[model samples]
Target: MLRFGLVGALGIILAIASPALPAAAQKRFPSSAGELTVDTVASGLEHPWGLAFLPDGRALVTERPGRLRLVETDGKLSRPISGIPSVMARGQGGLLGIALDPEFAQNRLIYLSFSEPRAGGNGTSVARGRLNEQGTALGDVTVIFRQMPTIASNMHFGSRLVFDRTGALFVTVGERYTQRDQAQNPANHLGKIIRIRPDGSVPADNPRKPGWAGEVWSIGHRNVQGAALHPDTGQLWTAEHGARGGDEINTPKAGLNYGWPVITYGVDYSGAKIGEGTAKPGMEQPLFYWDPSIAPSGAAFYTGTAWPQWKNSLFVGALAGGLLTRLSTEGEKVTGEERLLTDIDARIRDVVQGPDGFLYLLTDEEDGKLLRVRPAR
Candidate 1:
């Protein structure tokens, strides 16, 4: 682990203190991180959102415009896979997160999170399907879980999916802008982390009681787009986008509230202060945060053998800031942070370590590209 002393760490501490940190501190990152070599492995994507790596080295990516594509190890970008369910491709709602089944070796199954269109409006849903031999067709797609109440507007669709070691699926949903107060409502699924069986059935051990509508694991999130279980501790860590300034990195506790609108490091988009204050007694505080919101999107922990020094660190993608941040951690606490691939100047949507011990990135744009980062030898 590397230590930068108290003076350097003060900037990070002050960012989460409130909304008074300077812009220079917001942009300043670690000065060094060894050699990093980045390459455009695949291109020609349309607003790529989420990504998952297969055991055989293929990559499954979701495009916000309602398409899923496979990128082979040889850098071949395959055609869009068919049989994806219809998506409400509005502002932020559309085809979102993807994850391979924990037992994918035998099942050849994959899970997806997307906006499901309904009579009244659209709601986020989790679907599972099998990948075909050529990776161009989705067979036997099944809807396992769907958000309870569909609503209008398309801003905050906190759709990120990941499976824990137990094979249970964890899905996130945004407030949907229909109801701000619904975030604290255990009866509503909006702005909550839901834990369910692979087939979409509610888990018996969900953080909430049996009478609740769905399996809400945690609540009070504005738009949590990034989520990953810590490699060492098995705890779930999330990165959420704030309205104007507050972007938070938190280790979500079961049944604990994460206070979004009520207490935030951010204000409204029009530059007005949000809620009453930045912290409250009941709400859990963030482990780390950014004042001038980076609009964090995807998250993953580095445990691959290729970069042993990077093991246990967090890799997060920034959409608004257009950078890839590597957060060094000591146990459950973040001690250091470095920004990489800022020269690419693209809205990084997702970051993951590939099967081959390399880093993979998905850019968010009309012609988004898949990038690979390896050690510069």
Candidate 2:
């Protein structure tokens, strides 16, 4: 069982296991979709994933190799910012998402997601800190939320952080590549989107039974890397990677089960079908799905002024598909889908709208890049 106390810990060193992909599955990578143009805004980064625009017109990026960087508006990359704690970078686990406190104007608080070591094992953790005067190192850091009951596996640490309009925080955790069953259990944090206070306390209004923990907002997911609240509806939306197929975009209701391994439209990596047949009665279906798997990561709604025709569309980053997907949303339904930047062929890991009204993306790779997207004339 997972324990719930707090202490400084170190992750277990992985034994250099063989690659998780099946032998026959290895092939040329970087999938691309329909035609849409993309342009590079900046280059020269190490596995850039998460992005957060600061109030000063600069943006902060988290590289999976455990570095936090400051990118100015003119595309200049600052020296690595300090104060990030140690992280386990084995497989998909590492420094993940970044978000400023909704009340950052007064508090100067920021949140981060990373894989932290713990007793008996390691798991995904969230920490908070303040940026220093020089915008370099973070100071006054504290761990707000840490997954209990660490395990030995090193894959599927979802670790996406987003602050809703109400100042409540939503965190996503993968099933750790071993606890697939926990995705359907209300008792576990794995494969779930958790809702908490900015200070890391479980809110009273969470979808818990009278005596159960209240942090669980929705359950039954598989590595949900992208989560964002709809700009007009105030509803929460998420994108998750499926096994061999069945990438999904879902709007989760309080207490709804999303049907991960139990009823997936996807098959296992070995080409075996997963779960019972799709469409279980109690589980919610995806608002949209991608077959052959886009391996989606970050997501956000486009409310910026630069893209006049995309005023309320949803932008999703694809890790496997190597493109950004634009979705049309109306009343919680996805009406149309378009693939963007298929020609660039970069692993688009995170997408966010800049305060300057342009779209930004961070690529995923050993040598990744930071890119900006605008409407082509």
Output the number of the TM-score-best candidate. Answer: 1
State how far residue 54 of model 1 sits from its true place (Å): 1.4
Off by over 4 Å in 1: 1-31
Each model's C-alpha lDDT?
0.79, 0.76
Instruction: Give all TM-scores, in the order shown.
Output: 0.90, 0.88
**Residue clash pairs of candidate 1:** none
Q: Tens-digit lDDT track for model 1 on 88-195? A: 998898999998998988989999999888988888989999988778899999999888777876868788998887878889889887677788787888888888
List the candidate 2 regions with Cα displacement exceeding 4 Å: 1-37, 210-212
Please provide, for model 2 over 1-377, each residue's C-alpha lDDT reduced to its tens digit, 9 standing for 90 to 100. Answer: 01111122110000111111111211121212212224465667889889998877778899988889988767778888899988888788789889989877777888999999776778989999998767888998998888755877789999789887778899999888788988887887888888899889998778885433478888888998998888887788898988977888888777888999898878899998888977899998888887778788899887765445566788888787476677767777787766655545679889887766666778887778776654432
Q: In model 2, what lDDT does residue 123 have?
A: 90
